[model samples]
Target: MSAPRGWRPAELVADRFETASARTLRLRVADWPGHLPGQHIDVRLTAPDGYHAERSYSLAAPFDGEFVEITVQRVTDGEVSGYLVDGLPVGASIEIRGPVGGWFVWDPARPAPAVLVAGGSGIVPIAAMLRARRKAMADSPFRVVYVLRDPGSLFYRDELADEEIFLAYTRAAPPGDPRLPGRLTLEELREHTLPPGPEVTCYVCGPTGFVEATAAQLVSLGHAPGAVRTERFG
Candidate 1:
């Protein structure tokens, strides 16, 4: 693909804490063109000495509005995410390079049943799809299976409660735990995921291994390989 357009300055207009380790930055990009759910932007930060560090993060939902939100998970020694999630100030300015990607986006007009799966911080993009679904108020069914260590670690935990989303805790559990404190099994995945069909579109995002594992399970459950879309990070 060609290089992204000119780096647009996005003012950090708002922010909120999602989890202890993650936070959201709402940027108001000047002259911004609207972006689809599941797209991403490359954020660039510059220091006083003119050295720059950049990282790409998926655009979280509610992006159709004037400002877009991107959630950052602080990584130990991560040059960009660490600063973004823990230190970036509201109203500060950063440059962004894109609203990029096409295939992973959810098209509201198509109106298919959407199966969204996420592992840990990978929930960002999937959250966008959910927001878009809400904004459009379309009748297509939507389901989610979010994998996190515990309830406190889930992104958009409050916003997603009323939706048909399932949380899979891979590590610890909260009160009245359901799965005996373990990783998501094939049974849980099968039970939560909608049966595969042409009218269903499955989107799975997470670390490389999690995406691979989840996509494989979906295919084994009879989802067409082409019907499942995935995005991953290291």
Candidate 2:
């Protein structure tokens, strides 16, 4: 993919969601270029006196060549997020850059059995991966295990209702759900059946602790360290 025409201001057009806590922001860029799944853009906001703050957000929707969608979670003290949730509005303008970062991207051409592990809002990039996979009509072996507090907070609730997805809740239990009750653990992961072979690739995204612990567990479970890719958000 070509580089996005450098950083520029974009207009916020809409914000809605599959759940309340998670929101998808639709931005109208001047040029409206395409980006790879798993990439992020840098958002910049300025104070009245020119003091500025910035944050990097992963794209939640597939690159459609016309608009960009970013999923944001409201963080208690997060400057960018707080502004986005409260101060920003439809028709608001914001400065953003990229189509940046490539370490976590999924390429349909090199499809492999993939295991996606997400915690909280970390599912953003995984959502992009799903869209990309579907667009390519690639039957790449793939499965997603999303861990959250409860259904009320699941980022892409409706999208994940499909049979191919799995949920692990740490706080509230879904009625008749058979998966484990607590946070994801190596033991529980081991109990779940996975496709055979060492070639299976693992993609993990979430808070720092969850990503680190899960990657360690995958390595110990015989998955190649090289095959286990990770992206962590604080």
lDDT of 2 by residue, 104-219 (tens): 88876666678888888889999998888888888877877888888688777676776377678999877888865788877767655254367677888999999999889888
Q: Please, what is the whole-model Cα lDDT of each candidate in the order they appear?
A: 0.86, 0.81
Best by lDDT: 1
Q: Where does model 2 exceed 4 Å of error?
A: 191-199
- Cα error, residue 95 of model 1, in Å, equals 0.4
Query: In model 1, what is the error at residue 105, expressed in angstroms?
Result: 1.0
> Model 2 misses residue 24 by how many Å?
0.9
Per-model TM values vs. the true structure: 0.95, 0.91
Best TM-score goes to which candidate?
1
Could you give the C-alpha RMSD of every candidate to the true structure, in order shown? Answer: 1.8, 1.9
lDDT for model 1 comes to 0.86
